[model samples]
Target: MPPIVLTIPEAVTASKMSRTAIYNALKDGTLCARKSGRRTLIPTGELQRYIDALPPYTGKV
Candidate 1:
């Protein structure tokens, strides 16, 4: 079958998050993910949603 999902690495690249950051986001419930067997798969739609909804980043508070 064709590829219908984006993997963790792809999601990280798209999300511009590091591995630890992604895991942290997942833990914090800010980012969403799924497990397929032994691999983590992130839905492109949801990734986009998160990206679009992310708050603007500044140098500091």
Candidate 2:
């Protein structure tokens, strides 16, 4: 089974987003994260929700 939580780097890889983008999202409340000790973890479902909430592609650009 896939992991339920992903670290910052793992989230970047799985979402194909830059580390800065992920951090920005977290900072801006666009994405949610959890704390495990000193590590920040993103839930797979939360990431999926964030992606789903994005506007659909219109193929205009």
What are the Cα lDDT values of the candidates? 0.78, 0.95
- Root-mean-square deviation of every model: 2.8, 1.0
Supply the TM-score for candidate 1. Answer: 0.71
Specify the highest-lDDT model's number. Answer: 2
Task: Please write out the lDDT profile of model 1 over residues 1-61, one tens digit for every residue.
Answer: 6356788888777768788877777788877888989998877777778778878898797
Residue 20 lDDT (model 2): 99
Report clash pairs, candidate 1. none
Regions more than 4 Å wrong, model 1: 1-3, 57-61
Tens digit of lDDT per residue, candidate 2, span 11-56?
9999999999999999999999999999999999999999899899
